[model samples]
Target: MPLRVHDTRRREKVDFTTMNPGVVNMYVCGVTVYDLCHLGHARCYLAFDLIHRWLEKSGYDVNYVQNFTDIDDKIIIRANETGEDWRELVENNIATYYRDMDALNILRADKYPRCTEFVDDMISITADLIEKGNAYAADDGVYFSVESAPEKYGLLTGQNIDAVRSGAGGRVDGTGSGKRDHKDFALWKAAKPGEPTWESPWGPGRPGWHIECTAMSMDSFGEQFDIHGGGHDLLFPHHEAEIFQGECHTGCSPVVHHWLHNGFVNIDGEKMSKSLGNFWTISDILEKVDPYVLRLSLINAHYRSPIDMNEQLLKDAEKNHTRLMGVYKAALELMGINCPPLPEGDITSQVPLVKSLGLLEKMAQGFAIAMDDDFNSREACAKVLGALREMSRMLGILEGDDLGAYAQHCVEWLEDTAGSVLGVLPTREQTLVEPEEDPRRAEIAQQVEELISRRSSARTAKDWPAADAIREELTALGVVVTDTTEGPIWDLL
Candidate 1:
């Protein structure tokens, strides 16, 4: 099946094809670099990272470009509040951005152009807009005249000129004064006393938020590209203004072939917000959750579907991730690959040998089918992981020569589909290191053993209530107790 994507501009799912046959020039809107990134930022980047991986896996040379808005009103405000230089603030935030992204294993883009680096290009584009009568200079700065291209006002948002003018569909840029129309957004702003200033045709000022993206993207990939992606919130004035500016400047009708927008991240049942006390930074979440587990939780839902993040969701992802890691480790060991020892109570048992012809091929095709359908990672991940678990169960039953070959095939299949495409699986070398022993391991083991002894006594005495109470106590301490034919066994949760 050919790759299909949901185009935000057309508001439909369409077959994805690049302008160049085997090359994709893609651009994604990046962070503003004012503060630490949050869950929403993780979702947006992880969505694009998935697309990037699938594109490469499907035999496309993807030239992905993601920009950083280093110069912004929020950056200035944050710098002022901290009494730090705005440049220093942006640098620190960008460093932290890379730290968080690298921790999550997101693939790096081909180009990461900062807004400050492209100020000259922005000035030139703003100047050309003024010369072409698409923008006008006012007392405050330069503003794009929506009247100049009324038909292109709401190309992405589906808003007409009346809707935009009424402020019903699009955001009004209220930074600059003396605008001829309420919908006319700023191209450049006049310099303020303490803010960063740059030399431009419209006096000493900085580029506006929207213009920075247009200048950086077009400069990188020319007037047209294959894909432009961002969060759903950027579908309005931000992207709408980009369409207008790009078309008006380059005389290109459609600046991009496909526009993709990922859905929002909701906390509990409501939108994530600082005021709601549900705003979670990526660093804060990483302090408690494993990076791979967090990645799975984020991609469990379709990219276009809202993900209601909560404790249960993360816990479910953690369980699934642990299962995958266990299978991977066991498969490696079956193929004579040395790996870190599994937990004390974890055991692998041989199942009945079955016909395994075409199994790997079938699983690979199934994964591709799910991913080809608009990057449905939720289905793709489930298909791959479920098949791997079954394969691992059968690893012990294979004969001498067939055993090694089959185990190798299973490892390769997992590496290609889940490791390369989904990026949820760590490499064998990455997982080979022995984890540091916990200081409380001896104490916790003693407690667990004592509780299990008490529970066993209670069970033998026919005291169901006491046994249940001890079991609950063990569960609270993150231990899972199971009854076997011989005796009760326990494992750390």
Candidate 2:
């Protein structure tokens, strides 16, 4: 398959004929470990997770690498506030990140390089840049000579570099005495009192934020790779700097074949932040709703479109997710009866639940087409839901008999191809916690209610032993029964 991906350099679609046949090397910017993962991070990572799954399904050998910015200012500040070691802070957050990713069913990357671990590599790259006259060190720190690089610095973002150069003057944290221009960004920061530092030729210090990625990417994926992805916010100075570092050192343009960026997520018409009090932690939301609801809400919007995070959107997404699962179950049941026997050398034994092999196959095709058309997950998801609704009505998995043997076979294939391969499913076993009011829950509630009523009656009748036994049994089952002015009520333990 000839994949067409959006090339940020050209600001247009580009054909992805690989430099090495059937092999794709992808690098994505990962979370800075200052805080817990949020929905915004979910959107960015899940989008690429889907891409990774699709590439593998299409028979491409993919080498996916993501990095941890474990040495950023945020991590330092967080550690200082808690009086903990900076490395400890990052390690704890990294552990939390893995748990969240596992819960979401996002696959692990082939390599998870931490910025601190690659300090030597970063030093080498910075030295190379200095030797090539693309960077310089000052009394404060080393900085990249942005103007020394090629004039195509703004090509990827389609912004004129000169137009924005003036306002950028105030943004530089430290004034690098050797910097020829205000737009020059730091390559390394000189170690300060009580800050993390490593020995380097330039002095004792650490790699700057942008330089870490450039060095790590070069070390892991070499001079060029198939794809580079991150949030849209990184497109301007960060990505431009990365391109500059790669090209100035290696004398190559278009260091990456494709660039992908997911749009920002907004909460209540504003970007999420600590100041807004609307910033939600993944752990916080997990307590209130299942993770799949969060995943569905993120993927429902186009990966490049700004998502307005609101309760209405999530409620609708949850309903859609439930309806989709219900439909898939129904379709499987229908296939059992209606599907024909598979001939030899066939992939599926049953007729596809939808006109396609399964609703997912059609969705997968549509998803590829949308992604090819600039990663439009919104349109692709709409088409998938439509097919799901149609097939669900025919199959009756939600409220019908066991799927026929043939339908079961088709369901397994489609579920694996779509759910496992694409990272989109109505219900994953890990995220599918029983609802508070599920029938089983209700049954337990009813039994508890009956027990409370019986206990009340038993107490009134002076049968103290029966009442005590009922209360103990209910308590043992995680029901804290209590009597109140209104009536008896229970709370889940």
C-alpha lDDT values of all predictions: 0.88, 0.77
Worst 10 residues of 2 by lDDT: 394-403
What is candidate 1's lDDT per residue for 371-447, written digit by digit as tens?
99999999998888778766866785675655665666677878998899999999898765566556665559888
Weakest lDDT window of 10 consecutive positions for candidate 1: 342-351
Report the C-alpha lDDT of model 2 over 1-493, residue by residue, as the tens digit. Answer: 4666676677777787666889989999999998899878887898888778767866889999999999977888999999998888888999999998877778899999988889998888899999988889997689898778649568677777777686576655464355667778889888888888999998898888888888888888888888899999899788988888888887877788788888899998999988989888888887887777777788778777799988998898889778766655544445555445533322253543323335445555675676556556677667666656545553443222334643454466447544665555645443344345655557687788888999999988999999999999998988887887777777776
Best by lDDT: 1
TM-scores of all candidate predictions against the true structure: 0.87, 0.80
Cand. 1 Cα-lDDT = 0.88
Global lDDT of model 2: 0.77
Q: For model 2, what is the alpha-carbon lDDT of residue 6?
A: 71
Stretches > 4 Å off in candidate 1: 166-176, 336-354, 442-493
